[model samples]
Target chain A: MKTQTSRRTLLKKGLGSAAAAIFLRAKTARSHNIKRYPNSCGVLVDMTRCIGCRSCEAACNAEQKLPSPALPFDDRSLFAQGRHGSKRRTDENHFTVINRYDPPEIDHPLFRKIQCNHCQEPACLSSCFVNAYTKTPEGAVIYNPDVCVGCRTCMIACPFYIPAFRYSSALHPQIVKCQFCYETRLKNNLLPACVEACPQEALLFGKREKLIKIARHRIRNDRDRYVDHIYGEYEAGGTSWLYLSSVEFDQVGFDTTIPHEPILNSVKNFLAMVPMVLTIWPPLFAGFHLLAARRARAEKTRQENNREKADEDV
Target chain B: MKMFNPENVHLPVSGSKKNDGSPWSFQDKVLLGLTPRQYLSQLCRNRVNWLLVLIFGVGIPLIVQRYFYGLAAVTHGSNDYPWGLFLGFGLFGMVPLSASGFLLGTTVTLFGRKDFHPIERLALLNGLLGYFFAVVYLLVDLGMPWRLAYPMFVSLGPAAVLFLVAWHVATYLSVQIAELLPALFEWLNRPAWKHYIAKISLGLTIAGIILSTLHQGALGALFTYAPTKIHPLWLSTDFQWIHFLCSAVFGGLSMVIISSFLISRYASWRCGKEFSSTLHDITLGLGKGASYAVFTYLVIKIVAIAHDNEWEYLLTAWGGYFLLEIAIGVVIPLILFARGVRRGSVTTVRWAAAIAVIGIIWNRLNVAIYCFNYQLYQEVPHWKEVWLTVTLYALYFIVYRFIVYRLPIVFTWNKQSRKP
Candidate 1:
């Protein structure tokens, strides 16, 4: 039994060393690649130029072929009561909704269109377990309904609350969100319907890098007309949709306080610990068990030896 | 039922019957020593049954209404507050409370603490039921509950934190069931099955530890995806997972302590002498462990706040609420647990455990629902949503009571010891 136990320990040690070597090699290879998406397409929304016409909303609805709203797109009353002190948001039926925010100091109400910001490193994409969501090089955060399990974790995980579930359906429920016109417009390298329909030319479409240059140029060229900072330039590790506002971005319905780093980076701290615990805990705990068992074995042996001595004396 | 010799019939006091040489039927096993009439009488006599029946009566219809009419039918249908009580109470509240199984398993099996062995099965049972019901709550809340297997067999989201949570929870649930199988085998007079399970016990325990660690931390990591939304006081990029994991250690232990107290007080008939006698000692031991965990949690929480330099937020109302959660959930429970352990006062410890359990639930709810998007107006859950949450919890209670009444969780099956 002792020989067998020793042999097993030796084998485990050999396997452990081999695994360590392989893991180290893999870590080095992973560090070497460090890939980043460079040529992604993006949109820049200039809030100063947008009129609360709801034209973008109408265009998005028509383009997506979504169900008609209970209120007509022309109904201005819908903008009277905004959502949670912001503006209207994306839902299962509506991929994009324009919201009106009236700043106390400003004479005119500002319109900010809400949809999937199409984040460069989207939380929804990272939070999906089934690989259901994809951030295409065309700069659209698209979802595959076929793989979604209705876990709603993505809904919980999304900072913008962009992903909406078709909860009413009993048989074939799926997540509904804006795909940035990936199928009809983005695939053909054409501007999204929302951008095309905006009569004020409030929305601009181009490569993300080029869009950043245009946004900066607008801000630098006419300093008083636009906010100094681009809304999506650093928020949540930048997004495909950039925003330039006349008033403070927060005043115009943008979440200005979101961290610059990708949200997944926060979670990775915990994830990195998982494999370490799995590898280290078993052997460590098992070793403790062996040590405890050894003491029991030694005690039993001593008792047996003493009993034999006592029997001989008798 | 077939008369195994009285000496060989290793049944609890209520489990035995005067068998007249026939195989025991499922009904006979369920009835145990009670006559069919007596069992029926007991079932009808319980007041809890009427409450459950009423909940199902009302809630089932509402659930159906939800499906037919849409989330708008049963809920206020606020797009702003997408998640309501179903998630707040069920998923967030239950998962932490269920942490007892892995914690206790580590103590008894890995650490060789034989004194805790008597109550180990109860802890396992508590963990299993909590997780099972959490999933049940998930089903009720999910738009397409039937497609739950999509993440596993159909779609793969390897990058998602929730993906890890779903896979790990499913895997851990299986692991927990496997861990509890030995008790079931023992009760069924299957010594061979018991031996086989015992042989693989170490492997299962390690797996439970690993799976529990990831999923429990994953639950917290799920919140990391909403970094800006969750209040900074509760949100810690570096310490969020650790905070969740540490809290669960005590949260699970406290749940076991609370459950044991309830069993000893209300259902003593179901528990054998071995369980009842050793329970108080185990409770104290568990309290000691809980105190240590709570202390660590408190320190890490402070470190998290300090790390982020969020000291100024303490002056705000949100900060006050955060401090209140810490005070009630961490400080008060820690003090109570410590005092109870020092005084060897089982009653005091039990009360502390109950408080800790409630405190843990409150903290989780605060993180998931209340403190979430703190800058925005607070979302009050819809009436139907609240009702649905209560209905699910009632179901959990019924299942727990049913299992405790029959399973050899608190009591050992006498037949196994009688054998060679």
Candidate 2:
């Protein structure tokens, strides 16, 4: 197992047996279409249209039944608040937040609403050991509190830093994040409360395939008003939510440096070696032991033979 | 310094009779053959004990309060920084240092390097305590400490990196215990049990190597998930596992060297002639291994940089911090170890090893806390949280000292069942 798990020992023996369903489905999906995701859903946010009303935040809090915010949602002063050089981000209490980004080149400050990107290959789902996270066909990244062991690996794995642990809860602590309203809205064919409550018609709900086209259409037609890129089209292997900003995505607090590939791509190199280590290390080390033992026995016999011959000669 | 006349020392073991000819009891063993009053007086004589008492006086209740009032009472538990010192220093820092167990086990048992046999048991004990304490740290850091076993038995997410860590650590902990069982059995005067373990020692050692390799590297791979969160210089996606695994090699060796130095200085009374006399040579030998490992780690770290094409980031402030870590932790130790080994200076090697050990902790801290969320506000550890970590380490110290004092780790056993 030691040698096999090295770069060699990658397979999880227990998991291989227990949860073959997920793997089987993945394989089936791969066989059907090698290039694209099948029937995935998505959302597109138009920053040019956003009024920074905070109605989405208010609606999300009411729908999720989360604790009330420290200040009322109507307070415009929250946009000025920044910490550690960054704007206010999503936390346990607030699943989604709008941060005011002042790009000097642009006349108006951009209001960037940050939440779970709900990637095609969600890092939280991949990194979870208990399989607590699921990427729904409707483009929602849902979390199961029942199976969550609260290791908080998901929080660390997420490229967007979307997930948060309810550390304050001692007895029944679990991960807190936007599930894209998977349970109360998305699953029921209704729009996420945040999307429905957007007063400026900024949040557009549609199939992930169509959202890409819509984002490109807006950028392609209005070249000067919008940046030429869609924020989540390929970032972290494409997310359910696509964004079109007037200025650069980084100017509006988006992590522009995220890789085009999924987060798992980085870890797969090491994981691939685990099986190799497990398979090769045991026999190789055991062979070394056998050779050493043989040599020691040979030396011992040689010394004993010489001693006996000397005694006979004497 | 007065040389210890280790030849006259009698090691602790079962069936050893007392001066009056009566057999030694378990109570006598626990009390170190001294009366309760004498033991108390001896403990009180040390200033260190007083400090430990002060730490425990405050630390113990805080631990209780954490359980009752929850982790929020003791920790910042910040949403930005989910993992604090408990994991960064305790699990990530300590596990690699404990790699000595497998390295030495493979050296003395699998490869049959009889010269390292004297200090091999010490290496094994160091590994055991490091791992055990790491788990203790995990217990304190985990939000729902009771559900720790969920990754193992209840709802196994075998595909998860943490799941692999949980299984491997638990299994390896057992393997290490088995590898050390001969000594434990010998101390208990159970020759039969010792003989039984001796037959399977090779298997246990091999298991240790396998588990140690994957898990040590897996710990680094854990950070691979947080590509954006961790600073690029600290978090290498391509070579993160290799970087972690390679550093652990030196980290583990350096820890063994540090433990040996401490044992020679503070545990002379417990060491046998063979152990005390040969420690200098062993220290040098271990230094050579560590120097090689550190050099490899440095090269690989550079390779990781090149592979990622991260040269541009080098001009930034985070790059300076990364370079400082390499210079102080890796480069200095590598140079010092190389020089110390060549000069055959035990003191030089000892200092080099100490620096290397500190480097391991520094590197882990950089990854888990310092460089983590570099763009966010730093989460300073709560004073109680820091104290609790200190308390757990003290407990680790006490347990380690107790085991070394009683077991045939530092000392040589005269039992018939004992073997290399």
User: By lDDT, who's the top model here?
Assistant: 2
The model with the greatest TM-score is 2
> B22 in model 1: Cα distance from truth in Å?
8.4
- lDDT for model 2 comes to 0.85
lDDT of 2 by residue, A1-314 (tens): 44545433345665665578788888876753323566777779999898899999999999999999888999999888866656787877999999877799988878888888889888999899888888777778899888787778888888898898877777877899998888888788899999999989999999988888888888889999998999898899889899999998877778888989888878887888899999999999999999999999999999999999999999
Which candidate wins on DockQ? 2
The interface RMSD values of the models, given in order, are 2.2, 1.4
How do the predictions measure up, each by TM-score?
Answer: 0.90, 0.92
What tens digits encode model 2's per-residue C-alpha lDDT throughout B355-381?
Answer: 999999999999999999987777788
Q: Which stretches of candidate 1 lie over 4 Å from their true place?
A: A1-38, A83-86, A298-314, B1-25, B67-70, B416-420
What overall lDDT goes with each candidate model?
A: 0.82, 0.85
How would you class the docking of model 1? acceptable
lDDT of 2 at A27: 86
Cα lDDT, model 2, residue A55? 96
For model 1, residues B1-420, the per-residue Cα lDDT tens digits are: 113224335333333222333344457666655568766776777777888889999888988887777666777655556677777789878998999998888888877788999989899999999999999988877767778887788877676777778888899899889899977775565657878788888888888888888888888877887787889998887888888889999999999998988888888767888999998789999999999999999999999999999999999998999899999888999999999999999888888888889988998888888988787888888788888888878888888987887778898765412322
User: Please, what are the lDDT tens digits per residue for candidate 1 over residues A1-314?
Assistant: 44555878899999999999999999976753423568788889998889889899999999999998989988999987655665567777999888888889789889888888988788888878888888887778898877677666677667777888776666666788889999998998888999999999999888988999999999999998886999888888788899988899878767777778777777877778877987997788788878877877898899999999999999
Clashes of each: 9, 30
